[model samples]
Target: MSQEITAAQRQHPTRVASKPSSYRPEVQGLRALAVLMVVTYHIWFGRVSGGVDIFLLISAFLLTLSFIRKVEAGRPLALGRYWMHLFKRLLPAVVVVLLAVLAATALFVPRSRWSDILAQTWSSLLYFQNWVLAANSVDYYATDQSVASPLQHFWSLSVQGQVFILWPLLFALAAVIARATRVRFRRIVLLVFGVVFVLSLTFSIHETYTNQAHAYFDTRTRLWEFAFGTLLALAIPYLKLPRPLRIAAGWVGLAAMLSGGFILDVQGQFPGYVALWPLVAAALVIVAGQTGSPIGADRVLTWKPLIRLGDMSYALYLWHWPILVIYLIWRGREEVGLVGGSAIIALSLVLAYLTTKFVERPLRSMAWVDAKKRRSGVVIAVCVALVAVPVAGWQQGLQVQKERAEAEAVQNNPGARVLLDGYEDQSSPESPTLPLLSSLGSEWGTLDGDCSSYDDGPTDPVLAERCVGTDSQDYEKTLLVLGDSHSQQWLGAIQPMAESNEYRVFALMLGACPFGEPNSERRPECNDFNEAALRYAHELKPDAVVAVGTAAHPTEAQDNVVAGLPEAAVDLAGFGIPVVAIRDNPRFGVNMIQCAEANGDRGDDCAFPLSDKLSDSSEMAAIFDSLQGLALVDMTDLICPDGWCSPVVGNVFVYLDDNHLTKSFTASMSGEFDRRFHDAVHW
Candidate 1:
């Protein structure tokens, strides 16, 4: 939310016939408090503080108040002028912070994160970052060692920006309906927003229950939060309360809002019915507006210092997250301690004050820029270009470098051939690594096409939709690849084998779901997918079923076979199909490609001891001894040769992120994989 409602009011005053316009300092103080909650909870508690919800509510409240007054006074909405003016005020500080983040990312963050940062930069600049993040389906609650994206907090702002455009259209539609039907304007406005609040809240509850990670950033799921604010605005003018009840509500609401982060599991359960706790608390405080009692929450909220801080609340919110994230990355800490956190907050406050003074206030108040609608639009365009032009250029540069490196890899990179006994090193040591760091983000292996294109694909909808298949129309053998992304990554090697052996490959893989019997570890959807895949495999009766049989750990000493692999294998055996289970690859705690980019490619600093990542022998061998038609294939020697796994193997980057093997690296293992597969299946 923009946090410049007072400035907006001053710039465009609406003629109110019934209720005279009045400035609410308590609301500004509330914004200040919400921003502090978000910063402190993020830096120290590592939890959601419900502050963003308050911001969304307050934004809609002020917006509705402005538009409804204009509609009542028979004044033009001037929506085009409003959008340009609003975004002109919002975009300047956003552009500054995004540019700062780009520079910080280059200086402190690893190379692996640059592509994502660049993508998010464009998304943030264009106000669609939330959808981009939802499409990625990242778990916002994850507190792993993986560095947080500096621009991730922009999701809330993106949602607000989207609502700002849509909410005004909603008001315009209500005005049209009132004029056409001769209904009271206030009644039509309430009916429209009330319907939105109900429908959006219902969808929000359902979506959050089903897929919370995606729902957390979904604009549809958050629209109700904004609608609630609009509904409250419509009701507030007629809301009459006794002095005692208003005074009590003021204190009660403030207490509830303060206690929400501590008492609720906000990270795990939010943006659902549970979110009503904070929204209702905020509504109560707003309803308790200007209780004259000295002990009332309004008296505390209207403090002069809080009012001043609220003026810079948007800047503070923008500056705090990147500072906290970069600080944690630089210090190599999970959570900032009290002293460091204090320093971070202090630095953020200073920057926020300076940015508000120098950038936000000046642009909002610039008479020359604000004189004409086109001038405001020009300011918006310039702000977007300042960040987008450089980001796009950097992206193009990386792509060019990656293309050049790929061209040189054909003759220079030997990959797994170098691991074979009696193989001589034919290439010079100066050869560049295959799948260079610039191209590492696109290294995940994928099939030639989905199964829908094949005439002989599975009849089951789940299998047909989820499966990826080879292009071979006629083949001697059919091979089914099943399990999680680990199994899918092996397609780089498997596809080459299929071409040589004339085997048609169809892979049905789900992220994080190993091919196994239903278990507690798998989500309900994953378990259902695994069951569907098994039934499809039985019906197809492929010559052999391929799956990753073991689980690798980043820090564990001994790797083990997946919990239900043997059971799944036995079920497949019942259908007279052979199972060729590949051993899992080594997983590292750090990004290997990033390490290689930081240090020299040949340096030992990027190597991890094999003993830490995997066991010396395959655990699946003994576990599947009694199971008929089951054979184990272990390639740990090639992956982590000489008892130490290095990031680069024979001038090729091995792992894409921490665990997933790069397609180029896997393709290099085709020779060894071909030999092992024939020996396992004997087909």
Candidate 2:
């Protein structure tokens, strides 16, 4: 989009053939507008702007025009040379940003975010950031695990990378067909893209509705936008808008792009039918064809200020998100207001200009690397290697830090003391050690990689090794624990009970899924997984089914909390299995370990009101009371103890992240858990 790039992505001779496509300042202006929309939405609204969708279209539209022209001209397509040029041009600026993020992460962001940042960095470099993000998008909890990483914005860039690589192949195939079949090259290419646009758009609409959180980052789902652009490109050579219509369309399109964020619920509705708002708008502006009328939006879009900004748009887009994120982390704000957003925008602009001028332009235009295909390829390889080596070192450093933290993990483990010695006064340090305490959420009771966690789900995989029994061959009563990660977190506490009593532990846990009503949450495969678990339970008919019975939907801390019981328990009771339901824990909605690191041991500073964390989820208990064999186990007191639930209690941290309990802390509650189990179920 930034023509400062000499990637030769668009063919040289083709640009002449594809006149009017030669220099579309209006398109560049659209690019500028898109970047601004993204930055503004991210900063003030914490929502996706749909502006990125516009860029995706424009990028594909231009590339398709040039490639089709080349294919029609009976050229070699210069696949090797074109790819080599892109490698040299696109990656240098990206690498600089990756390096900058790494540095900023170490300096400003908490150690909690380091690993995720590193993962995103590598993912971005490999151009599969969207997949990585999609994998992590839906987890055991109701909310995202961490603050949006500095590199998360790179997902769109990854999609662009896919387009850049794959779009040419489509054209190359079209070229082959055109030569062999005596069909018009343009018509063949158009036919192929039209087919792709329909198929991809259909799949996208389905995926977005069924699994929207992930659909936002799914490359498969995004292909429609890119393919749609190709279709437009194929049509553009024939498009000739009248001056009056062009003038009207240019204004209409600009108005839509500018007003999209304000008028739409992008987060809930985007990456689906709603995405057409921006994509279609950009398409109209592009097809409107730089009208020379005073009323034309191009007259505004081609303004010098916009053209210059558009030149920096790529760099600006790359730099703005991280800058905004780091700035918010530095200021300790969950969301920013006008002034913070302005400051972030100011700094981002300054950095964007600097990076474009110094890093992107100079590196993208390097004459030495541009001379030969082999040389350019070597430069690209070297640049990637440079980033990878340090990232590898940094990831290893985090591993070493985790080992040290685990070495100290034993001291933090107060076996059985939570119930016996209970609530020992302890002062939390100003901050927990970096990487270790910050990384504890990942360090839960190891299922030895066999047990499926959030990563394996919303696709459920059944495993048995992590399922412990007094003796698998001989157990009087089989205990099946069911639910998601919150359900899995209690494994340590429940394992002790399994050992003491003669019961085999069968964990039918799916991350973020608890068998309940209608599968309204609609996490992917959740309903299927829950149904399968119910069938598995009926087949096994475990002596007792234990589950974390309440759903704590994410909300503000001050909101009246309502923890509803999943209907799985009632169904289990119907199956004649006495159900043990543990009350869900308090949710702080921020990473507890990270909060402790920042705020120290001040319970008041770190803790929210117990009332805010728990409501009369007791209604669930009453519902179960009517069921013949269902028992409600309320341990809210164990978690929140006082009126305020402390993040760290009795020298052990409580919540692992926002809601789930620490494995060590849960283990420490063995006696209380045991006592409560006997009182509630009387097994």
| lDDT (10s digit) by residue, model 2, range 532-636 | 677777777778777776666445433221132345666776788777877677776677777876887444677877776555545656765775556777777
Q: What is the TM-score of each candidate against the true structure?
A: 0.93, 0.84
Ten contiguous residues minimizing lDDT sum, candidate 2: 1-10
- lDDT value, residue 396 of candidate 2: 86
The stretch of ten residues in a row with the least summed lDDT in candidate 1 is 1-10
lDDT of 1 at 541: 88
Candidate 2 ranges with C-alpha deviation above 4 Å = 1-21, 141-146, 415-435, 443-477, 496-503, 510-532, 549-576, 588-591, 602-604, 607-627, 631-644, 670-683
Model 1: residues with Cα > 4 Å off, grouped in runs: 1-16, 138-145, 459-461, 588-601, 616-625
Query: With candidate 1 superimposed using the best TM-score fit, by how many Å does residue 133's alpha carbon deviate from the native?
Result: 2.0
lDDT of 1 at 355: 94
